[model samples]
Target chain A: MSLRERYGGMTRAEQGVSLFVCGFTALLVVALLTGGLTPSYTLYLAGLTGMYVLLSLGLNAQWGYTGLINFSVAAFFGLGAYGAALVTASNSPLAIPGGVLVGLVLAVVGSAVVATAIAIPTLRLRADYLAIASLGLAEVVRQIVLNQRDWTNGSGGLRGIPDVFAGWPVLGPLPGELPGLQFAEYAVGIPGLFRIRVLGFTLGEPFWTDLLNFVAVVVFVAAVYLLLRRVHRSPWGRVLRTIRSDEELASALGKDTYAFKLQSFVLGSVVMALGGVFYAYLVAYVDPGDLEPINTFYVWIAVILGGSGSNRGAMFGGFVVVAIREGTRFASDILPARLPVDVPVLVDVYGAIVSDFGSTRLLIVGLLIVLVMRLRPEGVLPPQRELLWPSALEETDE
Target chain B: MALLELLANGLVFSSIIVLASIGLSLVYSIADFANFAHGDTMAVGAYAALLAFGVIGGVGPTVLALPVGFFLSLAVGGAVAALVAVITHVLVYEPLEVDSIGLLITSIGVAFVYRAIIQLRFGSNPVEFGIPLQRPIDALVPLGIRITVHEIAIVASAAILVVGLHLLLQYTDLGRKMRATADNPSLARVAGIRTRRIEWWTWIIGAGLAGVGGGFLGLYNQLSPRMGFDILLVVFAAVILGGIGSVYGAMAGGLLIGVINQLMPAISNVAVALPLVPNVGPAYADTVAFLIMVAVLLVRPSGIAGGETT
Candidate 1:
């Protein structure tokens, strides 16, 4: 059977595998919780992973699905985070919700405007130039943001922003106490058995912010996944795929490729911006340093790892990639202090030799990308469809 | 006097930029890929020069160090560039069969690898040349224009290199081969030209020039791991503005950008003097080159000289 046919035939098995994976993941989480893992650290990692996944999905929408090369995803994300920070930092209550809404709106509008403006002059240029131009534009945005002290507070950064769910209690169900879910008081039975207090209202600590952020991310991802999946199966999606496969053919058929690309750019940018806004709320601070070009590549790695064109793949990619990064740090922290002398020396020497290795994660990431492109270009979770999608669709086509 | 000083400073800066950009433009034009590691190659040159100076020892050692530094830098840069070109071609570009966009992304990865290695060795700190030059020229020149001997040497070397490159490209058989390879690699190959050899030569020449530029820059402004990366954007802007693939254009673009960047802030008061608008001072001049680049890009996507799109 053909590869496509084989893949299609495995749908039921794939579902079962996914179920098993989910179960296994839950079991692992439970084990960690019971095994005395730092709750705050775990929560923080979960929130970060969720954010990365959101970003990866956004990028996948543009790059994998639409075949649009977006080198400025991080810039959009940064813009949203900064926008959220600016709004939340304001004393006005209207600014809080308004800030998030405004952040998302501006991110979409601004990215669209920039994309449109650039496309007019550069769309005809070779694709590579477009990539360069986009990269340059991202840098320009970063510099502008950095230079605009009056608005962005410059590089010193904006701090002490009000959290979206600040007044909410930690380790509790939503604001209202739900019936049939009693707060379990902490009790130790056998080594593995433990009960924790939940329900009602216990503020506990600031950890609730992270939990809320994770929930927010999950909801957002679900909504986007459903929306994108629908679009991917639509007639417009077919046209987008055609455009990706052959732009000239798409344009020959009277489709305006420029308009389609602009739409995709705007939509992907908006999603990234939303992720940024959520990230700001999670961190409670926004800084220029947080929005480096490296962040864009990180998202790229996630998308590529998961499966570029697949929404599910993007989510998986983001989670796995973030987990690896955060898990490495945790490993470093928790690893045994005393090893064989020779081994310790080797580790120390290697660490010193690759002192910039941490920052050089991009290099590692690049190598991984190269390896993926070579060995498994389809990625770990290949998209269901063979055809690539165009970034834009005519309103009539839709 | 201050105006003259600024002009002189701008000229010196422009010379350095031109030296750096021309090599970048050549590599991009010929290889059809942006060597993201180009900046690090420059850093390598600076470090090589430092090593040479350290080995030679004494006041006169710097004078002797220039050629040794330049040649060593050229060798190192060429070797690294060629190795990376081959590796990238095999690992990244060939597999994807994607266009230069994919290659460029891969180049970013390669650049980081080179940067990490450099940082591993150099510890990311700035290193000074610390060569004390005689002040006869500085004292003799009017307008408080203090052009050190090192600066003079840099200017002289840059002029020589530019002229030499122009001649080689215009008059040499190798230059013709490179041009042919750049214009149509398949056609060149069909004509029995060894495209791979031409590419190797192109990388060697281009990277060598970058190395020299880096070494000179190290002399002028402290040698740091980031120095090359920081200046890379400006160099790229110069390359694009001048028109990609045009060496002369790159040089001209570099000098024009450098001068405009310096002169704009000086003339900021002119805008204020003309109308009701208040003067924006020199603080924003740092962004002048980038603004010009953006404006130029908007106006002419193919660039000022109108060669390649990027």
Candidate 2:
């Protein structure tokens, strides 16, 4: 009892907070390693992980909270990217600053619109049925992006979309020239602080686009994390979970389950769209090929790998996915020479195998998924019961 | 005449969908979830034939040896795919049994692993049956409608397999047992039927037929890693349309989708009649399934063949 009280009553909520912090710390360690080894692409890939994290979190809201299996995360994400790009691209009526701001807002609203359109008709069916429709929707969207030359540029890809930093004049003299972000660096001693040492080896110097983007992503992730935590404690979230756990009861109580489900689905996709805008700006390009069903699966893999229902798990999953995906590229570079004196032929064969790591990574990821599902279906960090009211009741009679 | 040709083309594709959807229907009823990897099972069958061809090299060319080559490819494809199905069932699906959602995710996992392995064994490029390179076979004009050797072969093989499956499910004691297990596994188990044994056979037979279906699809379309997945949703649309658990429903659904997908792009009037649509109708070939799917769920959620909700 004493131990339980010491660790905040050994409550699930404290464990959740501690685990989340651990996940964040692990991610910081990874980010530092990435920056240390591959200075150029670290922050850029971190931004990508942020993008995927948001995608998974969007999915988590539907599948984790409301038990809706929507397989069209990639579609909404693509729409968000394309929607924002269309609004902000140089050729658009709304360009640069105004377009960027309006485009971001429009991207979220447009995603909500798309989500509502799909949800209103389809939410009545079984969850897996929605999966079927969404899968087809993705294919249709991809076909449109691929076939329509006039509208989507027909797979040549759309480029020249300005980043948020690019639109901001105060941070300017056009920071595109900087090698990387010098605004802050993850200080060595305390990763938990995500402790940034501002004036990163320089004064009044602009940061690289990747660095600027990474900082923005960190802020975005933090804000999203706080918002989701709030939602988790809110009445709306309670209603969403009620619909998931006991739909008949929720309906019996006069709560419109369909409307709530649709609302949650739209809100999740709206977040995905916001992430999509960041992704579009970070990459400065959008290709129809990038929006494959596999991309969605990859996000799902991350979501499940990190723990689907937990927000911190989703964030960690995003990092793990990016790490496995991008980190393996350097596998061949690290192998072959690094192993202690080996059988020459065996070394050669191993080298040959690792050389195709790009394709084999799929096999590894697939195996990881199977193992994870079979062993830990709840995810790496399972959803725990959180303690909302920690204040003890006062005794007035004494 | 253009419409007739399109319908004929659609029938060829429909036959494949019908063949694949049968296996999916069986699995859906018994396993109680959609298997995202089933399409990959199609790929598995096609690639098995490809591997068999690599080993036996002369399965093509000589007119006298043509039938021998075809049977060999079919046998090898079916057998290898059955083996793979059994292995994955044992390794993944059986172990993750409590929740259908876990099984669903596991199916996706198997699909990823299978796709990666297929790409590893065979290079990333598309492979074709030796016949596609041969001189164009004369098109048969039966009652003034042109049909290629591919279409005839597809239709005939699909007919034989469907009829074969029907007989197996209806006449044989094994068929009755399989159907019983599919309908209600616990009830069948209580009735003294070896439910596990029945499931084992279901995987073998269902996946075998799926292999054959996949082989036929690849025969006409050419085999690629993405072929199975590309056709996955259409297969789901067919299976769901046919009333998910019914064999006959799968066949009917396949043909409907096959025809609709071919013809809808040209005549999906809802999009065509609208102004400033940018000629999206022809490009909307895949969109028809999703539109129809949403409509069907709204009007008749159980499906056309009257599939009961599990």
Candidate 3:
């Protein structure tokens, strides 16, 4: 479909969201062109956003589709990261010979096992039980990772992890083999010393590597999205939704809700681990800190705010999270350094805030969660289209 | 002798856990959601006490090595925490139209907001009360028990509060009404008991106890923005063990978990004594606690107290 046709099909809210997204993208590109932001940094941010999108999508499966409150998003993600890192990283104690392939398989498989183990006991209880249990279990996993020096290298973390395309034929050598491209610097409407140098950016090895990572994530996200779309419109997906809305009704229909819930939990967890697999390659590092509960909440915000049970919303929320994270860091750096005001008390207040921007980020995250739940519980772009199997819908029309 | 010392340490830690778990259990059933912010409420109380200490400035005599001002600050902390929780309930929770799960998720956000504000003001680094650290009592040295006066004070205060809560639940009109409401809110309303008023009272009594517990926790260790959050899982474990929404069970669960947590070294020693078992360290304390919670869920979902409220 053409851009105009797509725009025409969107609701007013969707249209507004699309326009805002476009505006933001354009501004980001402009910033890159003006040398205000580096190309490599922008690509890195995009890569992180893609990782988050994968996580949000994983969560959307459990929470949006089945209403399973699996708070172990971080746990699964960590397992995936550790899985890949252990087999692939140079510092790994039990480094396997199969490289990235082993890592990817291990990640998904490990997460599936953990998810199943967790689901068995908790899925039998109330919904909130899973939330509380998963959180505690996540902590348990992190502790094991932190203390198991023989296996995980303890808190020192694994490093020297190869890129995702390290063993690929052409792509393996792409980053190093690619030539550096530099844009000619131009003075923008100012005298020599005071001039802003626009278009002086260089696309080098780091940029190429980040771009490759971004491309891999794009492909991963696309594949997952198509798969989720198919599953979400199926009769099975309908049963899951039935369970989410009312478990008793689903049970009355002779559907085994526990098995369905367990399946959903494992599937979402594996997907989350896949995201972590990508993350291990993207950052080329893995640590216990990566499993922090805050990361889980970040994805939670993305899923809920973007619109629960909406694939596009999950994607949108993922991008917004990166914005919140890096935007705060950027603001903290720039705002404090160039405070034009000379007032003492004002300076002190501003200085204090910018000095510890971590707290500000936390506050923003907290407030956003509350505001989103309070103001728009359905989220920004709740599933607009009724989900039905394509063939079933067509038969009904006939 | 070493085991005895561990027992002593466990009792001290159990007092704080009991204080935290009781409030969480009370809120869990009555409020009809696991208040994730309940942990942060403890942090709020601790900080309030810290602030009150700053203002009170160790004025007057010291009791059990804690200044009279410290007790006043502890009271202030409890009051402030209750006030903050009531304000949050009125503003955030009461206004929002959502189910128990929604409230649970929102409470996570509430928790973050509380921690963030505390971190923003005090910075993230841990800080101790102005109260000087007390050495283990000279009298208990020969007995191999390294207990401090501050610890004794914590146990005493917690015991008093727990007893007070017991009396309130058993004898007071508000207590009876609170129990009736917890058992069945609609029925209580039909019976002319104002459930809303009871909920507020629950918040007051529950959060008030948590605040005092938090104050004692600060005395036991140091205060940080994440202090309560860090211990949240353990408290949750206690509540789940006692049975969620069961106040008396929370007390029993808290004591058991606390003792078990402190006795980690001894447990590891026992493990070492057994063939094919590896020795573990204190680092696995939370891990062990969580595992126990999972075990409890598997064995007795209703909890040790059989899932009865209050």
Number of the top candidate by lDDT?
3
Interface RMSD of each: 2.9, 1.8, 0.9
What class would a CAPRI assessor give candidate 3's docking? high
Q: Against the hidden true structure, what lDDT does model 2 obtain?
A: 0.77
On the 0 to 100 scale, the lDDT of residue A351 in model 1 is 65
**Candidate 1 chain A — worst ten consecutive residues by lDDT sum?**
A175-184
Q: What TM-score does structure 3 among the candidates reach?
A: 0.96
Number of clashing residue pairs in every model? Answer: 5, 0, 0
lDDT per residue for candidate 3 within B1-310, as digits (tens), equals: 6999999999999999999999999998788899999989999999999999999968799888888999999999999999999999999999999999999999999999999989988999999896777899999989999999989999998999899899999999999998998889999999999899889988988898889888889889999999999999999999999998899999999999999999998898788889887667888988899989988988898899998887
Residue A261 local lDDT, model 1: 66
Model 1 DockQ, alpha carbons vs. true complex: 0.40
lDDT of 1 by residue, A1-398 (tens): 79667557566535554664577468557645454354556666677777887788778777876677777777888877876777766532234465455655665566556656655665555566556566666777787777777668788787777656544355244433323223443544556676553223233445555556677777887887778777776776666677767888989999888777666666677778778877887777888787777788778878877776877778777876775566455555655644435675577655654444454454466566666656656677777543334344334247
For residues B1-310, write the lDDT of model 1, one tens digit per residue.
Answer: 4667668768878888897888788778877876566776677666666666565534333442344444444345434544554555555555665466556766666666666666666677888766654463646476567666666677777888889887887789888888788778899999999987887677667766777787778877888877777777778778778987777778889998877766765678677788876455675564557666766766775577776422
Q: lDDT values of the candidates? A: 0.68, 0.77, 0.90
True-contact fraction in model 2 equals: 0.75
**Which portions of model 2 miss their true places by more than 4 Å?**
A1-38, A90-97, A173-208, A337-353, A385-387, A390-398, B57-66, B132-146, B264-278, B308-310
| Tens digit per residue, CA lDDT, model 2, A304-367 | 8777667767877787788678767766566664346688776654554576776677877888
Model 3, A311: alpha-carbon shift in Å? 1.3
